[model samples]
Target: MNVLRAAIEVARFLEEQEVRYFMIGGLALQHWGEPRLTRDVDVTVLVDPEDLESFVDRVLERFSPRIADTKPFALRHRVLLIATDQGVPVDISLGIPGYEEEAFARAVWVKFPAGEKLRLVSPEDLIIHKCVAGRPRDAEDVESILIRQRLRVDLDTIRQWLEAFRPIIDTHDPLAFFEQALTRARRSLETGGDL
Candidate 1:
């Protein structure tokens, strides 16, 4: 299945319901960084913590859950895993206020060559998201973004968010990953994008 088409459908559904959301994960990476293959759709949806059940129920009307106990699982994990009618898997992150609110405000609508406007997380926000993910692939994405963006990204903002997330996610040092990626990205530029 086409990830963009499925993401577009899901995004449209969210818009119809007036639910605030933005495309994240690999798809957003493709817009800001290096193009890569990502099978599933990942989005951050702002839902009232008190209204999760109804929100999930509302989503169920348009999409089917990939898991058995989607509502309970989403409530516990803050992520709703489901699939579109065309069978493209999607992970809907239950976002709260504060940082997420800011990210939403910074989100941009990128008009593809075919005239499809896909809402994507900003480059700085995308870097933050990848840093939080902390996988090797995520590191590569960060590097590509840094190399492609150079001084365009808000490194200070990224650093600030990483510092705040530092205490919460002790298993992963988001700041360190960003720093390392920044270094490598610079080196790659120095070496003519060989890294």
Candidate 2:
């Protein structure tokens, strides 16, 4: 499906539209963790609910909505599911106010193997994303990222964001979740275990 090309296309389109967005999910994990096959692309767009229809309309020019009623579905779920011309699935997550907006602002430009550069969320922010999702796979991704970028990643920033998101997202203890993941990753690295 040429996922890299698809990602470049989506990034270019969003940049042209002056949308503040960043790549996340599998693609972001690929950047920070061990590379894995990812079928879909995930992007977080800093779009307001009021402007959703216009935004969806613009995206429709190059991508087809996965559902019949894209606007309503997006509004309800805060995610617009669409597919590229080559049938590559893309999930456009509507950015929430605080955490997401901060993540987008912290996104850094990354040059892919294809020599196409696109914005990607910071490693700290990506960890927060995975921790929040809290699935087994997500935790594994977090562990991989930690093992790979151990010295460089900012644990404080990740902790800060997780702490902020705790009350906002109604998470009981984000820091605990992060600590557990970090501990596991550290143990894996110490024992020479493959992540």
Candidate 3:
């Protein structure tokens, strides 16, 4: 479905609309860690709930919403699922009130293998996202990123954010969970084992 091209097109559209956004999820993981097959493009758009409908309308001009009531769904869940004409899925996360603005501020531009430049979440921020998701596969992705990034990633920042999200997400002991996951990743990397 030409996911890369679709990503480039979506990025360009967001840029044209002057939306502060960044690529995340699978596309981002490829940048920070091991490359893997990712069928969809995930992005975070920094916009308020009030303005979400306008954003959705603009996006719908090009991408088809996967759900019938995309606007209300996005306002409720803070995510909009859509697909390109070619059927490549795009998951757009409506910027959460506090956390997303900071993530957008911390985003840096990265050039993709196909020569398209996209703003992306920092490795530390990406780690926090993976931790908060808390799926086994998500943890595995975090481990891969941890091993590849090593000390270059800012652990303290990631931990602080995770701590801040703990109460909000109802996660118990986020730091401990992160440490445990990181330890497992370290062991795997050290043993030259697959994640």
Candidate 4:
């Protein structure tokens, strides 16, 4: 089967098992407004020890997940990488201590393949996440989404989030930086650059 179908099957399994997950990453941005191609599907789920064990069990049974225990010594949790039959990776985060609530609350539902419905992190949340993550790829992804979607993302909402999660961004003028990014994205769109 194709990657999309694989992801849908996984989502279906998750739903059937009553496990909650918030879809994040490139696919989610594409759904919002930006169009981009990404190989894997990334999901952030609320996971405790019991939830993690149950999820791992279900995923292994359903998809034959090949797990990698890659947690740091200081971290209390770990990430489970479940590779699909099509070789698409699904990164299931087992409980991020700080941002669990916001991640769940900001999820916006979108239609999946085969007429299935699933929740994805909002564009604003995606922006916040990428910025906080501070990875080069994340910046590029954010730029692509911002330009293509012309999201009209609520500046205040993003600003508030940054203010609340200041440590993550590691910058004092997050609002200004966010506005600058938005402006650059709009300019790129106006100039007909991959919008």
Per-model TM against the reference: 0.95, 0.91, 0.91, 0.77
Candidate 3 residue runs with Cα over 4 Å from true position: 171-173, 188-195
The list of candidate 1 runs beyond 4 A from truth reads none
lDDT of 2: 0.84
Q: Tell me the lDDT of model 4 at 5.
A: 65
Give the Å error, residue 154, model 3: 0.6
For model 4 the local lDDT of residue 130 reads: 74
Can you give the lDDT of residue 105 in candidate 1? 93
**Which predicted model would earn the best TM-score?**
1
The lDDT values for all models are 0.89, 0.84, 0.84, 0.69
Q: Which digits, one per residue and each the tens of the lDDT, describe model 1 over residues 44-102? A: 99977777789999998789999998889998898999999999999999998999999
The stretch of ten residues in a row with the least summed lDDT in candidate 4 is 67-76
In Å, residue 34's CA in model 1 sits off its true spot by: 0.6
Superposition-based RMSD of candidate 4 using all C-alpha atoms, in angstroms: 3.5
Q: In candidate 2, what are the lDDT values of residues 78-181, reduced to their tens digit? A: 89899887888899998878778778778999998888898998889889988877777877788889988863688889988788768766644667788988
**Superposed model 4: Cα runs more than 4 Å off:** 48-50, 67-77, 168-177, 189-194
